[model samples]
Target: MTLRWLLTGRVQGVGFRPFVYRLAREHGIHGWVRNRSGQVEILGQGRTDRLDRFERALTDAAPPTAAPHIAEREVLAWQQLEDFRIETSQAGDRPWIQVPPDHFACPDCLAEVRDPTDRRYRYPFNNCTQCGPRYTLIRALPYDRPNTTLSGFVMCPACATEYRDPGDRRFHAEPIACPDCGPWLSYRPDTAPAPAAEGEAAVEAAAAALRAGEILAVKGIGGYHLMCAADNTDAIERLRARKPRPHKPLAVLFPDEVSLLRREVNCSEAELACLRSAQRPILLLPRTPAPSLPESLAPGLGELGVMLPCSPLHALLLQAAGGPLVATSGNLSGEPVLTDNAEADARLSDVVDGFLHHNRPIQRPADDSVLRPIAGAVRPLRLGRGSAPLELELETGVPEPLLAVGAHMKNTLALAWDRRLIVSPHIGDMGSRRSLEVFRQLVEDFQALHGVRATRLLCDAHPDYTTHRWARESGLPVTPVFHHHAHASALCGEHGIDEPCLIFTWDGTGYGADGGLWGGEALYGRPGHWRHLARLRPFRLPGGDRAGREPWRAAAALCWENGLDYTPPVTEPSLLRAAWQRGLNSPATSAAGRLFDAAASLIGLLQTASYEGQGPMLLEQAAAGCAGEALVLPLLTEAPPWQLDWTPLLAHLRDGRLPVAQRAADFHASLAGAIRDTARRTAADHAFTRVGLTGGVFQNRLLTELAQSRLQAAGFEVLLCRQLPCNDAGISAGQVYEHLGGQRGED
Candidate 1:
């Protein structure tokens, strides 16, 4: 009997063909395996029992990175063959197959690099079938070496022999190379060319420069990263000055697990597993008491963004440095990470002290992905580098192909087709022309790679956002989804919820249907069909958008509403009162984020925000150890649009007798009470027992914990963001969900 099989999923670049060949040979079957149009295809002729065993083995024992499922199977005419052979890859018109994500260096490869007796001793690019770069080096589909950045390099005789031998581990590894035929490393100073060193010498030079308090722009698998000693405050300060980033925390490359533990970092089993996963993203782990690391590294944050080295090159550099090093994106603030060598030399020369250059070319720049352990799942915050080109399978399918253009901040794009939603990596805020162009390119690249011709586009209702504008002008059928609705729908879709639930969507700002700004929202229903049930009392935002930059304006607005006298000495209280009264530049908003900013400013913790969500983050910090009781607030539960009145809470916060720390802690507790009370009343009235917490404010661990505890105690099943982020990065996924639901007439 002869059989033909077509397989799909991540089966192209992950050594699936070689695994099949070996399995077939082990079964003594006559067959052939090859890649065709982003999938694996097989034709076999053998005894029925042997073929059945071969099929079982193929299903049970595939490559680590591949999850292949049979797309088609056909009984073929018998053409008895002698032995199994791996054939050449066949190209097609469209590459719709899943592209491989970057992988962490496997243990076997790592051991070979550090072992003196191994042929690839200390080799930075030593990789076999189990591990290596895949997405970053790949240029097109049918993932062969000629289609990657290593197309120009010819393999040596020894490596070629290993590639053809089915018994060898490097049988079909596309990135298989050695020192004689692989890319070499070199160290070049800013003003002078250092000695052209290869292998261990170049890595040592880079490490020495880092140890001596100099910043080195080192190229890795995805892109370049700026490296400096973590303990050297001078080097960190210099890097901060050069990059000009004021307060955002930088990720650190820990030398080993022991080094991270010495700094008083606690890693739970889930966090540890995420750190050691194939997609080695930076894990946000909580800090322990009496921490040894300098406070300047993270400034007011409680958790540290840390990661072990993912590549052999990174491992070698960290091993030589003997300590942790601050590893930040290579480019300056607000620009994309630098990938090209000449571009790095031209654009990053003024910022970096030296360059640890390599010959491998990066097809695109991908920032390191970040994950946080929350609600028992390692949630993705910034989906890039090792965990990008994300394919999420939806419970239902869409009628037509669609693209979801995400929000203005933490932007990402999604393409939905055939029950699969493909999300792009985290694109930076669309504030500059460069970032906007990059967003456009990402949309185009994803479409080209996945063979998606989007017939419809979905965007946020906010008119001024760059993402919304781009989608509207794309000459496709555009649908505008409300920001809070998008958030609620994304959570519902991620959990595959088809029933009504109470959703609390709280964040900084979103365009509301009432011609005002909305953030603190309570909705009832399922995806694509939700009704706004309640909101926090609306307050005027003095000076409109400027109030977001200055937290004191929000404080003044709240004080003016409560008939208070003080305004924290920011731009005169009378002027802000006039703006609020006349409705000149003031716009009314019901944003819970503004409430946090108001509370923070009232307690004198943050008057001006250095970054987005800075005030609320600092407020959480100040509330760390206080055990004060929560102050009760009034709740208006009579009408359909219930009000969470902040008047009584604000009055108590303005009291002179309370300590600032106690007030901050009380404010957090008070807000938690308000959410709990609102959920209780709304859930009882609507008879809904499930609640989903979404939006950017859910990133706060304290608030999330408080809300989850209170809601669960009230006998409600709580759903928090487990896969994607709670921020705007996950908005595209929500948009796609809503659109798909609308297609099925469920809206």
Candidate 2:
């Protein structure tokens, strides 16, 4: 008897063919197996028992990350079979395709890189089928050598031999290259060390600059990174002073074990695993500060984000330069990450002391992903690293492929095909022309690479948002997803839940569908759909965004919301009075962010924020230990669409019975209670059970933890955003999810 089989699911890049060959040989099958598109097809002539054993072994004993192997069996017509072997195929195109993303360097490649005797030793571009470059270098799909950067440099005979051998790790590894054949590295700085040639000499000059306490633009696998020694106090301070990042934690990249001792912190098994993953994200670790590090790197922050070297260049630089280095994103705050070399040179001339950067084209820009451990698995704070290119797999699917332009701030676009969602790297605010270009390019790159043709687009409900503006100009069918609802919706879709769940979202600002600014809010709903259950009461955003920079205006707005008067609310001589002149500049907003700024000023927190979210973080730290007082919170709405009015809470602050910490704690409790009560009322009316929480506000540990507890206690299942961020960084996923789901009028 003869048989044919088709196997699918994560079959590419993974060692599917080699494993299959071994299984077929053991079972005495006579035919061939080969990959066509993403599916692997097999033709074998053998007894039914042998065929079954071969199939079972292939599926069950697959490699580490191999997903379930889906197979189809067919009774073949009479055919004479030769020896069973793996072969190549040309029919790789499928009308409906789900392409897998590129992956990290595999173990075999790593061994070759470290082995001094190996031809590829110390090759920065060393990669094989289980690892290395994917989408960034790919110009097209089916992802073969002819279609990649490897096309420029043909593989050496020795390497080509392994690539052609299905039994070897390099088999079909499209990116395989030896040092003699692959891309070369050359150094270019303003002042070059004497005789800057190729290889080790170029690396030595770059190391010299680092050891001298100078900032250098060092290029690597993904893109350029602004590097400076972590332990050099003066150098670290210089970077901080120039960058103007007063309190946000700087991500540290350790080159070797010797330097790990300098920044190593109190970490659990989960934390360690996250740091060591292929994505190699900056893991937030708690420690008593590195003795070698100065206080300037992260002023007044509780933790630091750290990682180890995953690239050969970074390793060599560190080995030469000597110790821990600050590997911050190569961009100014509120701007897109530096991608082009010319762009980096033009913008970073003053910030960087010198250049250790080389010329290796970065096809797609990706920032280092950030993660933190919550339950056993790591919760991605910012999903980048080895996680982009591939789409975020969904549980509840959409009807058509959709393109979602995420929030205006921390901009990232989402491209969805079927249930697969691919989110772009963090693109900063879309207000700038440069950032917008990066955003648009990211969208085009993802669609072209994945063959995802979007039929509809999803945009935030906020009409005035930059992202919304782009969506309108996109010339594609778009669905307007309310800012807060999208936040919760993304969370629901990420964690794989269907029913209504309590969603607690607290962020700086979002345009509520009610024509108000919303930040601090709690709601009960599911992914694609949500109801406005409760929110912070209306307050003025004095001078609009001007108030965000100067928190005193927000503090004054808090008093105004409570029916009080304060022309100057604060004692700062620099206070701009026109900002508080009612309609002269002020606009009423229900933004939770305004509330944080207001509370921070009231509780005597940081006078002003150098960057976004700085003031709020300080306020939360001060309000941490206090067991806050209970306050009378009125309903913004009488019933049904029950809203917890901020009037009573403001009056409590006015009464002055509670200290600032107690008042903040009480404010959180009031917000939690309001969400809990309203969700119960809505659940009773609609008979809904699942609730999803999304928004930058949920990033507040205290607020989310408390809100989930209160709602869970009330018999309402609460779903918190995990796979995606609660912040605007993860907004694209929600926008894509909704547009894909029939939420959009047109496909």
Candidate 3:
């Protein structure tokens, strides 16, 4: 019997072809295996039983990191072939395969790197087929070395021998190279007249600088990272000053030692597993009560964003530095991470004391992926590095190629064609010209890489957003997706909830269907046919977008709306009140995020936020370990579109006698109760039992857990984002999913 199969889902760059070749030989099959487009195609000529076993093993015994599925199978005419062999990859037209995210160094590769006698000993670029650069280095499809940035480095004799050996781990490894032929590292200190160092000497000098409390811009698998000793307050303060990032938490890369990691942060088994996973994303874990690490790493927050070394270069540097290092993205505030070496040297020279870069050029930038253990799962917050080019299977097919330009903040782009959806990594906030340029380039690069020119585009409904404007000017048919609707749709799509459901799409701000700013919204029904059933009672945001930075504005607005006589901390409160009364520069919003800020400010937690989500973070922190009864938040259900009134809740938050922590805890409880009541009312009316919690506000662990617990206790099937984020980073995927759900009469 003869059979042909097309396997997809991470079939390329993960030793899939070699594994298939070995399986064919083991089963006494005589044919060939090759990569076509982004998939693996195999032809087998063998006994029927043997072929069946081979097909079963194709998925069952595939590479540990590969998620292979037989996308196509067919009985073929008998072929005369002597032995199974690997064939050259074919760059076919329709690429429908998952681009493998960059992987952490496998244990075997790490062992070889650490071994003193091994050829790749202390080699910063050591990687095998099962581990290493995949998406970050690849320049085009078929994932062959010639299509990657690594094509410049010719393999040495030993490496070539391993590459040709089908039984070897390095077989067909696209980025395979050794010290004799691989890319080398170079370090240039900031001080003039100091000569640059190369190879091991460069690594040593960079490590020495880090130990001496100097920040170094070190290149990694994805992009450049500004790294410094975690314990060095001077270095941390210097980086903060240079980057001008005052309070946004910095991620720290710890040595690959669990014991050392546990000394500073409390890690559960799942968090530890996530930290050591092949993806090696930065995991937000709780800090020890008395952490030895400096507080400046994550000031005022009880948790720290920590990650294990994801690449050999980082592993070697950690070993050399002898401690954890603060490894933040190499960029100025509100800009994309730097990928080009010359650009990094030019833009980040003022931020770092030296440059530790290599000759291997990065095709694009992928910042570090971030995950937080929330509501009993490690949910993705920022999809990047080892977690992006996130591909998802669609429940329904998208007939035409579609591009979804995500929201302005925490931006990401998505491309959907056939039954697959590919979401780009977190493209930083589109607030700067450089960031917008990167966003535009990423849109083109994604389309080019997939060989799919999108016939239609999806973007946020807001006319002023950079993504929306870009989409409007792209000359493609544009479909405007409401921001909150996209968030709700993304959550439902990820969970595969096709039934009518009630979703609470809460965030800081989003352009609403009714032209008002929405954040606390209860959207009923499924994607493409949702109805705005309920919302938080409207409150005016004085100074519009500026209210996001000034928590006092939200507090004053809440106080004024509730008719409370609380004095605000602002110098010109009367002017703000007059603006609100006259409706000048005051946009009425129902955003749950602003309510959190209002509560935090009312309790005297934060008056002005240095970074986005600072007030909410402090509020969540204050609520930690405290349990308060749910305050009364009346559900006004007299009308078709109900309202969640916060009149009673505000009075409790304004009580000066109550502990701030208790007030914070009660605020969260009241919101959760409001969610439960609203879900119950909506479900009772519509007979929909499933509920979804989505949007950036749901990224708050405390609120998500509380709401999820309440909804589940009320006997509702709750859906939360698992593979994708609940934040705007997942908006592109949501936009694609919303379009695929059905036509909504727009576009």
Candidate 4:
């Protein structure tokens, strides 16, 4: 019997062809396997029983990193063949394969690097078929070595032998290389007085500089990382001063040893598994109390962003440093992560004491991915590095190709055609010219790589957003999706929730359907068709966008609105009050995020936020381990569109008699109760049992867990973001979902 099979899904760059070759040989089958555009094709001839086993094992015993499924299978006339072979890849029309994200150094490869007798001992570029760069190196589809950035490096005889051996782990590994034939590393000191170094000595010198409390810009798998010893307060302070990032938390890269990682942060079994997974994303775990590591690493926060070394280079650096290192992105403030060596030197020369350079070129920049364990599951906060090019199948197909340019902050673009959706990695906030350029380039790159040309574009309704403006100027028809609606839709689309559901989208800011700024919203129904069911009672934000930076402005707004006499810590309070009364620069907002900011300020947790979401983070930190009763937040349901009044909670937040921690905890409880109450009333009226919590505010673990538990206890099926983020990073995906054929609600 002869059979042909077509396999799709993460089949390329994951040793799928080699695995099939071995499987066919074991089954005594005569066949050939080759990679096609976006898929794998296999032909086999064997006895009926043997063929059955082969077919079953094709998916069951495939490579660990491959998620293969037979897309098509057919029986053909028998043909005699001597043996199975791996054939060359071909480019087919309509390429639509899942681009494999960069994988962390596999255990086998790591073992090889650590083995003293091995040829690849201490080789920073050691990689096997099962692990290494894929998306960041690939220039086109049909993922062959010639299509990658590593094509310039010729394999040595020993490496070439291993590459052709089916039994070898390095078989067909595109990025396979050694010290003799692969890219070499060099270290250059910023000051001419210090000596330069090469190879292992380069790593040593970099480590020595880090130990001496000097910052070093070290190149890694996807881009350069600005690194320094985590325990060195002076180094951290120097990095902070040079980077000009005062309060935003920095991610620390620990040695591969989990034991060492556990000393700094409290890790659960699930978090440990995620840390050691092939993706190796930075997991936000609770920090150990009284940790020896500097408090400046994550000041005023209960959690730390920690990651295991994702590459051999990172592992070597961590091992040489003899301690944890702050491995933050190599870029200027408000810019995308730097990828070019020349650009890094030109921009960051003054910021670092030395440079650890490598000849291995990165085709693109993929910053480290970030995730957190929430509500019994690990959820992505920023999808990058090992979690990008996220592909999803739509429940309903679209007729034409389209692109979604995500919101201003946490920008990520999405391309969709037929039933497939491909979301780009996290593009930094579109606040700077460099970031906007990256966003535009990413959109073009995604369309080109996927071989799909978008005829239409989806953008947020806010006309002032850079993405929205770019979409309008792109000469393609544009669909303006409401900001909060996109947040709700992203949640609905991710969970395949087509049924009428209520989604609470709480974020910092999104342009509302009614032209007001919305952050706290209860949207009913599904994608495409959504009804504004309820909202947080509107309040004015003095100083417009400046209120987001200064929590005191939000607090003052709450005080003035609620007729409270408490004074806000800001200059010219009387003038600000007059502006509030006259409605000069203040904009009306129902944003739940601003409510948190106000609560944080009123409780004296934070008066000014150095970074976005800082106030809420400090509030959450203060509320940890404290239990408080939910204050009464009236549910005003007299009208069609109801309101959850936050007025009653303001006084409690201002009460000095209550402990600040208790107030913070009570604020979270009260908001959760309000969400539950609003959901109950909406469900009672509409007979919808499913409720979703989405938007940037849902990134708050305590609030999301509390809201989820309350809703679930009230007999509602709760839906939360599991794969994609609940923040604006997910807005692009939701925009694509809106056009995927859904019942249209009232405009």
Ranking by lDDT: 3, 4, 1, 2
Scanning candidate 1 in windows of ten residues, the lowest lDDT window is 255-264
Model 2 over residues 224-257: C-alpha lDDT tens digits?
Answer: 7888888887877777777766567788887646
Candidate 3 minimal-lDDT segment of 10 residues: 738-747
In candidate 4, which residue ranges exceed 4 Å CA deviation? 192-195, 566-570, 741-747
How well is each residue in 202-225 modelled by candidate 3, as lDDT tens digits? Answer: 899899999999999998988989
Where does candidate 1 clash, by residue pair? none
Error of 1 at 735 (Å): 1.1
Cα lDDT, model 2, residue 545:
79
Supply candidate 2's per-residue lDDT for 307: 82
Clashes of each: 0, 23, 0, 1
Between candidates 2 and 4, the TM-score winner: 4
Query: lDDT for model 3, on a 0 to 1 scale?
Result: 0.89
Q: lDDT values of the candidates?
A: 0.84, 0.70, 0.89, 0.88
How many angstroms is residue 393 displaced in model 2 relative to the true structure, after the best TM-score fit?
4.0
lDDT of candidate 4 at residue 704, scale 0 to 100: 92
Q: Which lDDT tens digits does candidate 1 get at residues 1-747?
A: 999998888897788988998898888889799888788889988889998988887777887878788878899987868789999898755455788788888898889998999889999988888788887887777788888888888999999999899998889889889898998898888887654565679999888999899998999988889889988888888888888766778888886576465465788766777788888898878778877666667778887788888889999999899888889888766666778888889888888899898998887667889887766677778888888878888897778898999999888888998778877777778888778877887788777776668998999999999988888888889999888888998999889987889999999999876767999999988887888898999898888888786898889889887777765565476776776889999889999999999888888788887678888988888888886566677778788678889887786677769887788778878877788888888866787888988898888877887788878888889999877788898999999987776556653
